[model samples]
Target: MDIVSHLNDRLLFAVPKKGRLYQQCVDLLKGADIKFNRSNRLDIALCTNLPIALVFLPAADIPRFVGEGRVSLGITGQDQVAEAGISVDEVCNLGFGSCKLQVEVPDQGQFTDPRQLIGKSIVTSFTNLATDYFRKLEAEETNGVGADEQTQSSKPLKTTIKYVGGSVEASCALGIADAVVDLVESGETMRAAGLKAIATIFETSAVLIASQHPTHKDLLELIVNRIKGVIAAGKYVLCNYNCPRSKLDSVLKITPGRRAPTISPLEEDDWVAVSSMVEKKRIAEVMDQLRNKGAEDILVFSISNCRV
Candidate 1:
């Protein structure tokens, strides 16, 4: 804090400019009560409530910005950190934008696993990440990178890299690259591209990255902590239902919250109103479960903020 604030630089943060991840960054900021007016240029958005300017860049470029100290903080995918080979520590993981990095080849290809890729060429936007994964896997027999595995890596990462801008999966049978390294949500696109995932590199999700040399660490972390709280509180609904004393334990299992349920005696001496939170996605199922357990008069409500 002392070192960062003494530098007297305007804090800069980078965000995914445009993509599925861009909207998520915006929603997360807003949920944290961070306000900004578009003013004139939409690309260079500002946070009106804090001493910060948020520059929206391609999601892939965020790690570089933070690494170069051009920006002090960034919201980006974890995959970007490895791809950029940057000097930034992942300070926090913001729980949205989850995806996986995987290797895919034509569904009918002879390749069944990574070992089959020994003499093959691969195309990917993420060359560094793929190289690291394979290099490490090849190290298993030696306990870790010893002389033999070093020779294997030096023998030319047989997997060639092509700078295909998009649709790396479709390049397989099309013959641009032998295999493709790309992000997968459900593997539906890989199948549609006539490919199947042969190996999983890593599970990727959105994260907050910070430079090793930040000029405003306090302000940078204050914003990050608030955004994390917002993410923690998302996707839950507060619910209350009345149930007979005999069925109280069953209803509790259906709608458990951060703490024990709040209970109150109802006008009917044998009944009590039980209040708790049910996850938004599980509401329907929980209600049915509660009803089957003798819960009556169920009420669901939304919560705007929850710190814990």
Candidate 2:
């Protein structure tokens, strides 16, 4: 089904077509078992496993589709949502594509403080956020510098914000902008471009956003819960092992789950089987501790999806 056909019947889900957040959103849907097949060059695809239609759009436009109620849900970066400046409900964070919106200056420039570039030009794709940041800073500076003749010399230090579609870092080198407000994932890109960040405006990550006027509430909640389950499973694992009853207390300390772990008597009188959920990152360390405490047959298994 296409976007035009799904306006009233099916839920339209907008995802990034190509960008840092594109593959992440694709993987999230795949992990949730929401399979989709599409014809070549088609912008819309119907999910084979769910009552959802996927619309491949530019990352910057996903928030607009959601806010305008053209789509039921969307997955895009928080920076995109902030730039769109729309009234949409943020359902959840998808936990990938994390980066910081930062203010960067040329390497040789002696910019030390955000206030130092008050009257300078800043270029960014996130024009809304950049404009708001400077407007607030200007207000604070104006209020703090009140009733002082010398300070009044710098009375209205407004930043000139210019919006660019891409290659924002080049604006500084090209002499079009004195500084830039852009996203920095590793800072390697900025450094290679001969720039350095002076101040971080905000951090952003991939987020699940929904239209404030959702047409399908039940399906929307189901999809959100399924995605949440997949995210939870990715971060945790089920750990099971046998430990002597005498060492249960020590082992429990290592794998104490959301609630107390399950402890059941084994065939042997003094041995017990323990099961618990452990964070994926800490599974190795927890197993080591369990082994040190005389646990045996320790197993770590992946969870496909989980509610808790």
Best by lDDT: 2
C-alpha lDDT score of every prediction, in listed order: 0.79, 0.87
Q: List the residue pairs that clash in candidate 2.
A: none
Off by over 4 Å in 1: 1-10, 39-43, 67-72, 85-95, 140-158, 161-165, 186-188, 210-222, 267-270
Candidate 2 regions exceeding 4 Å error are 1-3, 145-157
Q: How accurate is candidate 2 locally (lDDT)?
A: 0.87
lDDT per residue as tens, model 1, 1-308: 23344224568888898876989898887888878765454556556777777778899989988999668888999888878888898988887789888988888878898767755677888888888776665554335545466566665554456667677877877777888889999878888998888888988889988888887778877877787667656777888989999888777877777677899998998899998877788889998898899999888988777665
* Cα lDDT for residue 30, candidate 2: 88
**Which residue pairs show collisions in model 1?**
none
Task: Name the weakest run of 10 consecutive residues (lDDT summed) in model 1.
Answer: 1-10
lDDT of 1: 0.79
